[model samples]
Target: MRLFIQLLGRFGVRLDGEEVPSIAWKRDRAAALIKLLAVSPQHRIHREQIMEAFWPDQDVELAGANLRKAIHFARRAMGTQDLITVTREIVAFADEVQLETDMERFEAAATQALRSGDPAECEAAADLYGGILLPDDRFLEWLDAPRERLQQLYAAVLRKGRLWRRLIALDPTDEEAQRALMQAALDAGNRGEAIRQFDQLRERLHAELGVGPSKASIELYERALALSGAEPASPAERIRASLAWALVHLQSGEFDKAAELARETRAQALGGGLAREVGEAGAVLGLTAHMQGRWPELFRSEFTEWVRSRDEFVPSVFDGHLCLAEFCLCDAKGHAAIARSAQELMCVAEDADSVAGRALAGLILGEIARCAGDLEEAETHLNEAERLHAGANALSGRVLVLERLAEIALARGQKWQASRLVQRALGDATQSWLSNHLLLRLQALAVRAATTPEKVEEAILTGDRLLTPGACQPCSMGLRIASAVALTQAGEMEQVDRRLNEAERIAGMWQGGPWAAALWEARGIQRQAQSNKVRALAAFAEAAARYEDLGRPLDQSRCLERMAAVMPAAGA
Candidate 1:
């Protein structure tokens, strides 16, 4: 049977242009299910996947039953059972049913337009755009990637020269068009026109974005200046160039180079009274030092102090990262301050509608709450963070939140839940960046240690893989502390001592900073396991002092409790 599906403007199913009545659909879920099937790449979906996506909170049998009922409703809506194909393992549109959607036509038009390189073709493609795949169903997660892909394709076609001119006419802040025009002008030996284009772009960005030109735009302008044999760049331009390099270094994990460049940029920004630049630079510096495991005191005493000293967060966009990094400097002693700071970041993120900011804030708040023994609050915060990240489709943030939640689960003696969470996290962590993935693997290893004794040896091998030569020092030390704890649990006294010593040596390279205390604490656990009460007492005492000095009362209290448990009954 011939079918025309209108998925662009408003969703509809029509048999040869005659619309299917809305009353035919028994429930909204039926209509939604039809739409889901229509948008699927192959017009087929796994039965289990549909159940999980649509009826996630239901049990397996209930969800499967719901799927069958939804499929029936969909068939009823279309007035033909033959229009849908069903099986025990899969659900799909009928292979024999001749069905066409506006989306397929739109995609075809877009591809043709890009291939033809004709402005008329681009315009035709743009005419097919109806804002979204399903405007009324914006809350649907499955539509997000498809909608975004279409939108990106739409924007990309506009990059054609003639189409670009039209784009600029529609929106002067179309930087892609501006860049293309500038480059085209340069190629045509119209250097003056290129410079003029850059000037217009700078002005438009300033007027609209409430910020300076991006590094790319600035570099373009500088290149034009150099081509014209003009005077050298201003000091500000040089600093911006350096800052751009610093960002590249940071992404590439060259912390030493990044830190050096960031420090220079920060100094320059401070002298120029560029508050936003200063904050960005400091954030980079803090991140660089964190990654390098160097100058830990400076992270707190210098960078963190400066950020707080400001009346308000200068570069509000950087507030989330800076605030979260500041959260790191707060040890157990600073619970109130940590909570207050996280709340501030969370509020800032909420105000900005920044998903990353909200995710980071929620993760930190949840961890702090967990340490403070507020399991309910911890779960709420962590789940919020997980939801936020999942909505944004950000893998790293979700993985981090999952790790925190798993830790909380372990703390509450929910080992089964923790094990499941860790398994999921490990999959994503292995796919993430190197440092994060390594640290995450260590966390997962710790979770592994909880369920069985033999897994401790597995944890040791995992640690070895992570700490093999040329490891990132700070991250390695963090993993070492964790691995030491695992060894202590396994009663591997000698291995624990060696690992603890390596942790100390590495921490010393970073000036025996705040994280060093954890090494000593792990050492105490090892001593206790070895039945060396006197040495264990000393190690615990030192760790407690270290935590107190670092303004972390929670860690201090933890050490004190361990000490209390190991102490003798003096009155006896």
Candidate 2:
């Protein structure tokens, strides 16, 4: 097309490779008329709407006269009456004009790039963004939506291309871009760059808005500092940093990487004779292993020794790590050995007066009690755990403790309280300074506590986030089961079956315990939803038996009640 209009950056018109000087138009409305047409769908707008946009306060007859004069000036300025099409009700560019606009070109490029999902195409499209549409027309109300839409599309292209620096260039105060750039820097081992990016963003945000960076941003900055070893430090400090990085990996569901890093850190700590580092590394490794359904081999010998001589260890060392592993261990199988170890860990925490250790120990004890159908004891232990965890600000521990407390509340038929507890835990889990594993687990708890349709739908949507590959296996399985139960309640039989199938697949790796019992219960719920009373009763019976064997009278009773509900009253 020989006729081209520029709406981005600067506004101008070019015909036959020659610029149309602004002096050609005696009236400014002539140019505005073309711009309005260019931005409208199919380059067309009704004459009445055009008049309202330009001269809203004028009478209809007067606006019509003004519109005709503007059209005359526009055709005169463009040096072609053929380019302006005026109908009885609509004004548009003529069919033979063969006109083009930067806005149209940009939309085409953006559409192609987004549809292709190719980074190179995205980068090309991002480059074409140039600037916002019609900068000179910044004050025009009609330009606002189009300008914002183009800017958003430009940002999306930059994001799809992973052009973080370019995105930051477009908007320096863009925290999302800043965060992305900072992460990219850290991933590339450019710690200084990462820190500098955060500092600049923080300074700019504070100076401009008189507010701090978001919680997510601040937490990420802290993590970068902790994991980057940004400051000169002793070997112990570096070891601690390594442990922090491992913890991040653990939280992100990279269990194998976390385990490997923890092992390396453990070796270093052992070489340096750093007992505290060694213990913490073991804790990291133990937690990763437990999440992955591995037997937590790191705790076998050293942990036993620590349990044997509580004074030989730092009480804080056992606070969340080892205690959490033992809690998970107890969950996997309520074995006497696991319970004894938890007890021993609790004793050590008490003797050392370690609040974190005590809190974690109480969490484990609470889980054991809850599993054994002792809701009263579980609530007492979990409440203590929650208080201590909150005081210490141990987020993961607090989440676990609150989850158990919620479960206990649910067992006692307090769905509202259970939901409140779950929501409280979810609120604190807003950051991933640790693995988002805890967050996924909390979402599953929400599904269980959901009583209303809206709540159930919201919980199910959040629960779907847990079905990702490489999620913590135990949490993933638990979420699927919980989701199945919720889906059954919602009368979504197809979704319930899909969830159950997925849970069954996950259970192939390791099954039994409350997970197995929960799976069976979920199946029972699904069968009952299908009105398959025989299958539902059988499934509930199996679940009740499993719960009975695990010493969970409450769960067994629930399952038994379900079985009774589904059982045939008499011969038909």
Candidate 3:
């Protein structure tokens, strides 16, 4: 007979290919006994050791009796009395019974991998280490040492494999691993990644230990800066590097970091009397503000600066235009503003021949056309954006373009095509690490596109995971609305109400935006589901008006249709 025990993550036992029932192991001591035996050297231990662990307080006679009972239960659970044997003071698995365990497998693989120094072998070992051994038994004293040992082995395997990201995930405070990763980034000429690594290490150390990075780390940081042509370089090079770092932080949603870098860069540029560098840093700060929803602040300063430099063909000028265009497209009574800003963005993008800039410009133009209910124009621009993003191998940009196209397809009742697009966007989003905003947007869309009960439930759960506290405000609001709609379709009225209520609470902070419109639309759906025709119609009408005010004709029309569906019968 062959006995296979799984001691990692969760505990389980299988005889051959069939799992033993949980009922068989219902006795806690029985399961614990098996765990102790499996982890022991050669699956054997002294009877006194087992009794001492299981019943340290009991007299020797009673403890031995309890151990016998536990042994009996464990053997019965394994479906063979021959597997476990007792001889005088020793307890062991029978010599004839072959026993295999996940712990042994992981250790064997890790040992061989470490000895050979093979990446593939290391990965295999890492995969075998499911999690800390017997996580459910975390409080058990006997498990602690083994758990720590296995965890250390896992970390060593990751480091030996040069899987720096995975190693960082394993222990963010591992300075040696972080330094290796930073050096690797520098070696690969990824100055932005090197800087990001250093910043993460420094911030983590500061937050957790009330200290900063070590001197070696500080020296490497200086090397990274020197390599990126920062301070002590030519003024122009220094300013450019600072702006580049700011943009990197912005792209990764590190707004505070981006702001700090941009402010420092702006001050240095001003000191050097560098107009272009100052504008570039200011544009980055403005864009960061826009991303964080500081709309009024962005418009007050960045707006004026963009207007003054609208004729420039610099990438930062195009970024300024893109930021303004996106805001205008989302705000009420800004159709003409959006058109103008998008036009300027496109002009700068074309002049500079920047594929990414053109892709972004095309995407915003597509969003504008889509909101205006011009499906044909929207599809044309979106298709161009998708092509550009694809040609440039820009995964995040392509995912955004696909999401817009999917929305258009869903509006046109092409559920199959829309589903396909959403799935593709989700798959690509997973591979794009710095696309949290994009991921949230795609998750919300998935919730909206779900039709069947299973799909709707999955979408709701995914939305819940994505909409954590301190998430991006606009995207999280959108996800809540989408989840509300999905819950409504699932006929989960209570959950739907909760989702809408939470959305309303979030929307309360912002006076006027697309979020307000979406909340009204969701409320209409909820009221319609509850068969409150008058309230539903009222809600949909308000939603339609809000959408129209925001220049979103397509959304307005959708709300109007809902209003019609809930309007009181003519005779009544």
Using TM-score, give the best candidate's number: 2
Clashing pairs in 3: none
Give the candidate order by descending TM-score: 2, 3, 1
* Cα misplacement distance, residue 532 of candidate 1 (Å): 2.7
Backbone clashes under 3 angstroms, per model:
6, 2, 0
Supply the global lDDT for candidate 2: 0.73
- Candidate 3 stretches with Cα past 4 Å from truth are 1-198, 201-284, 287-332, 351-354, 431-433, 569-572
List, residue by residue over 1-572, the lDDT tens digit for candidate 3.
78899998788898877899888987778888889989988889999999877776568999889898999988888778888899878888888878999999999999999999999999989999876688655435677688889988999999899877788777666788889988998998887777788778754553233234666676676688788443354676556556656765776778999889988997787678765566557666766776787744454344334333432222233333332433334354666676667677677667766666667668878887887889999899999999987776667668878988998988898877888998888776787532455678788877777777778777767666555344655557777888788777666554566567777886785556688888888888888877777888888999999998888888899899877766655226
TM-score quality measure for candidate 3: 0.53
> For residues 1-572, could you state the per-residue lDDT of candidate 1 as single tens digits?
88887777677789867899867764767888888888898788998888877765568999888888988888887777888888768788877888788888888998999998898888888778665577555435678688778767777667752577766654567777888888898788776677778667654543333223555666776676567555565555556556656766777778889889888887787777665566566666766766655534553245234334442332322331332342354233566776777787767666666666677668778877766667789899999989876665556557767777876676667878876786777765565333233353446436343567656566555556555334555545556777678756765443455567777786776653456688778878887876678888888999999977765566788899989978872112
Q: TM-score for every candidate vs. truth?
A: 0.45, 0.56, 0.53
How would you order the candidates by lDDT, starting with the best? 3, 2, 1
Of candidates 2 and 1, the better by TM-score:
2
Candidate 2, superposed: residue stretches over 4 Å from native: 1-121, 124-191, 194-280, 287-328, 465-470, 569-571
Residues 1-572 of candidate 2: C-alpha lDDT, one tens digit per residue: 37888888777899878999978864768988988998899898999899878876568999899899999999899888878888878899887777888888988998899999999999888777767787644435677699889988888888888888888777667889899888888899887677678777754553233233565676776667677445744566567556656766777788899889988997788678776576667767666766766654544444544544543343334433533452456565545666676687777767766666667667778888887777888889889989988776667668778888888888788989989998788777774233345777778778888888878877877666444434556556666787777767776553466567767886776645477788889888877776677888889999999888877788899999887777764123
Write down the lDDT that model 3 would get: 0.74
